[model samples]
Target: MITGKNYIGSQLKAAGTKIYKTINPQLNIENPWSFIEATPEEINEAVALANDAFKIYKNYPAQKKADFLNAIAEEILALGDELLEVYCSESGYPKGRAEGERGRTIFQLRTFANMLTEGSWLEATIDTSIPDRLPLPKDDLRKMLVPLGPVVVFGSSNFPFAFSTAGGDTASALAAGCPVIVKSHSMHIGTGEMVASAVIKAAKKNNIPEGVFSNLIGSGVTLGTSLVKHPLVKAVGFTGSINGGRALFDLASQRPEPIPVFAEMGSINPVVILPDALEKNSKKWAAAYAGSITLGTGQFCTNPGLLLGIKGEKLNQFIDQLAEEIEKIAPSCMLHPSIKADFNNGKEKIQSQNGVSTVAEYKGEIAPNYAPQTILTVDGKTFLENPALSHEVFGPFSIIVQCKNNEELLTIINKLDGQLTGTIIAEPMELSNYNAVVDALQNRVGRLIFNGVPTGVEVCASMIHGGPYPASSDSRFTAVGIHAVKRWVRPFSYQNWPDELLPSALQNKNPLNITRTVNDIITNKPI
Candidate 1:
């Protein structure tokens, strides 16, 4: 059970509220957890502390900030069994998922730490003064990335560890030298508290300010709204449903100061199966897709909710095989009871839509809170006509769309909303004729997968985990990989300042000895 002792940095205070622990619906057991709702006063205090921390935190040396991030990762690892247990109890996710997400969280923190020590990510540039130009000599200009102020991060329920407190948003913000306040997901408050403790420990070890990172627990939207609308909050990061993310974006934009909100909303993550490819590997592809759709009970945002294909005998064969394979898989519990309820509702709604047919559903009774893996299909014309088919169901369910022709396939892809990923399953020769379809997919999604499942996200430097509106608040930026830090930073230019007065990344000598672009060439030596 969490006690007052667990509230790191800040003393536990009474805010005139009753507390309740979240129950595990699958196990029929009460988890040892309760969260203190942050009053309006507490919210202001947290944000104020973060704002103050930003003053020094934003200007702190990159190496020092790196140390803090690395320490947090280490402390989280040190939590070991305790962290994973809390994750599973609160989220109802299995042990493997809890551990995997914990690892991803740690990897994210350490990756940013590496970025800090290695330097050179700042994208420095030096334009030597045009001393002999026909026009008046221009001042020598230098540019590099600089930290924004305090940031507010809203964690997603699906990934409480990797996208919650001390997750990608907080890690990247800290890496960029910005203070962070995480609006902890109510679904996994225990996980959030454990991670918050890790951050506090790291802050102490690194001698960073106490308020550099704060975690606020709340079940409703009020706390999140206050944080994003708060004047001191300079930026926001979020991952959740389209409705929730859009509301936050609108709130931020409506603010008097109008801060940037990088919200990774919902995605159907469409997968296009070409006729030839289906014909070539119908059984194998069907099996692989069954695994992907059922993996993690389809909790992943990249779950291929929409499958598109040109209508033919091959397509029919593939759908039948897929239905058979999907039925063979067992139903699993969703992350939370609320999620399961919503999943069932969404599936029913989709099934009720005109021209929709249920291909597969759990025949046996599912235990409480379990999600029955379901497969539904609709024609290309009906899918295109009904916008409801395009929405995300957020569970282990998939809708197969049979397009009448290549043109219909193209039209469906074009008409679809933005997505985190768009996949193309094609035979080698068939791909040569589908350049337009591929190009259209690329334009609509942040990442394009070729003949591969989109469920597994590779944590690497080049990965882009964000996409166009509804998929994410900003298509220009990414939510994962080394580039996630870009969300917490903005470009700042200095014009001919004295070498000693400039930031280290922009100084004349570049004492950090990082590479800079000069005369269209990357060089460590400054011009």
Candidate 2:
């Protein structure tokens, strides 16, 4: 059922001569399907279609949009075993992981759908006219969040389901009334094709406008650059490497009409283990982190790649225990050969650095594309001196840093590049003494964890899945959760406009019956 073609406004087309196929990393062989790269013409047409669709689709009632989203979830679930099989063949992930990610993806879609039905996400506000004011009359002003036109979403390499076609970026954008054009990740083009079909089917069943959703296939930068630089694209959502995300961010910034790019990039999520905690529960903490480090082959952005602890008997014992536990677990296959190569390159780079030593590494020979879990150790002085030590290795690899004192630990935390998460392992009440360390970590990460690993990110209204600088292009906006819809919208105000002419959410009649702020008071009442 995979067409291996571009989805331009619900129609499948393959006019380009260039073609590529996805690799089955588990078997180290190419899949049967061949995908055509999107040409410049196709990209332009898709963008234009999205622009046209946005004019009509942006004004759709919340219920209709919610129906569309919910339908997508249903259609994806209908994909059933075929989807799971293709996902495993293309990405080398096990069936269980595919199912789990599929569940997460469906949950995200439904979460957005429910949010739309609830209808308070727009944050509408109104101030009635004050014609009887003592000094001068004030004009009536009504404001609400409105869609920001078409958005370009670049699928992440690691997360084929949750962050790919019909993923968070697409779901949140459509929920916010913005048309979406997704540049499918080449590694999982077949999976992308299947998901796109489901989305298009849902769109048609719901009578959603054409061009409201598109999935383009391309291997490199040409198609993505065209989409990002297109005059119609008002925003972009990306999840990938720092270089790749930064390039898109730069391209969007340099355009004639600049657009916002919410790019979730690299992170070496750091963990700080307090002395008392290490002394009291070194074995327990070590076992937990060993699992966290190798979870999903450590492809997670929230993987604890760096660990900090005071250099002493307790920290040394914890390190030995962690090394022993990690080596016992077998290595797993990476997503692709390129990813495996990158993991090797990153490990080599870290090992080549002065003062870096391997404390533990999987010594057994593994199949092609399988990554070896590794644990490296380095002194705080060496880690602080060399910025390369902080770079994310992007696989089942971690580095434990031995700090000389509390001051040095705090300094190292401050020096770390922005991260998606920072975890602190401490005995009860032990955190009170390391206020400075906690404060420094707080400033550097989007989320701070206490006595826990940062492996799993919960999807909720409160989760902050972004951070400063390289962790994400914009820390103010999160790449996960319901609030992500805010990234695709902008506030618009109608001054002295007639109630009948205003949008339902802002109209004085309160036809939608949703919550709103009227004259600084939260209510659902009509003016």
Candidate 3:
């Protein structure tokens, strides 16, 4: 029966059917044969199938599409133990994270279902005729969002469930009636396969056309590059390293028909500690920064990699306390061996830089594939002169930058690249004079936080996940939250179309009764 974990839908057994393995950094054991990786041919077929499905899936009634998306969510929840087990085994993340991620995945799918069924997300706008124009009579004009064609989604390794197979990108695209072909992350292939199965099952149950959703697995970039370059692809959703994402962006942009690549990439999430804020609560600030920098072994994209503070006794106290706290925390396992090697290399690079001091070097023995949390300090001049220090280390490591004055701090912030989030730890009085800091930070990041940690991302309508340039390939579209759907949709306008022929969202009678702009006025009435 070949029931020992293989590809779904098409029944193609992976080559050797034994590429899956688990890297437990804590124990340093690589367990093999947990699952299999789909071959490149299989990947090609998956995209072709999605392209084939788009012919009918895009035209399916919104209600039916919503049913399919909701059904997929329900089935994923049904996977239950199987899903959690595979998720834990593959990534070494705790069960709590797995369950939370599962809930988030389900919530995302159902949220998209709600958005589709409600039908207002299309943002229909209609302008009735101006019958009494002196020079010319204006006919009715209507506009609404429509699905882009096949969307290529590259799942992120850090977030296997919530940003993976049937994650936000796929959910949003499916809800908008766009077919999705996911390039599964190699780190969590088992989770990807399980989620892919759920999606395929739901598609069949809801009579969704074949190929509405497909999954591909490859450790290398061949399959991903092929899918992105395929003439049929209309958009891409990527969540990974700046280097990887940038490669895909370049490929997509250079295509004959340049498509949108929403790539959420690197971040150093700098936390600025104002002088008064530091003096008032140096110890507390030190502890908070220490925890944030080491959380998840510093694997989180929003981990506070950089800290900027004015040079003074308060800052020195904070640094001393931070070093003490970081060293006390037990070292933990990183995601992979390659990641650990890269982290150590990056740390060495920073240390070798001129004028950089090792505030705290973790001298403990790190288990294979594990990274010991380390904190380094550098003067503001050294930091400003060496832009290479700004690069992401992707492990439990942090750099404290000491500035002589507020102007130096501002210069440092201004010189920094775009980030996912920039935080300010400030006393009320200190914050009052930092309007320029706020403005500069706002320009440099997609989200600005006040007196809070940047580790947790809230999924909501207003959340802005993407930032300029290296933070993400596109800042106009977000990779998380409800607004993520915009990446998979494009606005289409119709002029003087027959009332009966117009889409329901734009018809004169307003059959959907969705909110729309009529004569530049917001209303739910027919034009």
* Tens digits of lDDT, candidate 1, 1-527: 35412232344443737464666756856776666777778888888888888888888888899989989999999998988888888777788988888999999998999998778789888787777887688788888898889998888888988888888888999999888888878777778887888888889899998678887776547788888889999999998989998888899999989999999989989999998888779999999999999988899999989999888899889988998998998888787788888998999999999999998887888888888899999999999899998889999999999899989899999998999999999988989999999999998999999989999887778999999888999999998988999998988888878878988877777788888886567898854
Error of 1 at 288 (Å): 0.8
Q: List per-prediction Cα lDDT, in the order shown.
A: 0.86, 0.95, 0.83
Give the alpha carbon lDDT tens digit for every residue of 1-527 in model 2.
Answer: 99899999999999999999999999999999999998889999999999999999999999999999999999999999999999999999999999999999999999999999888899999999999997999999999999999999999989999999999999999999999999999999999999999999999999999999999999648888898899999999999999999999999999999999999999999999999999899999999999999999999999999999999999999999999999999999899999999999999999999999999999899999999999999999999999899999999999999999998998999888899999999997899999999999999999999999999989999999999989999999998999999999999999999888999999888999999999999999888
The positional error of residue 150 in candidate 2, measured at the CA in angstroms, is 0.6
TM-score, prediction 1:
0.97
For candidate 2, give the lDDT: 0.95
Candidates sorted by lDDT, best first: 2, 1, 3
Instruction: Kindly indicate the candidate among 2 and 3 with the higher TM-score.
Output: 2
**Two-way lDDT contest, 1 vs 3, winner:** 1
lDDT of 1 at 131: 78
Q: Which regions of candidate 2 are displaced past 4 Å? A: none
Clash number by candidate, in order: 0, 0, 0
What is the lDDT, from 0 to 100, of the residue 421 in candidate 2?
A: 96
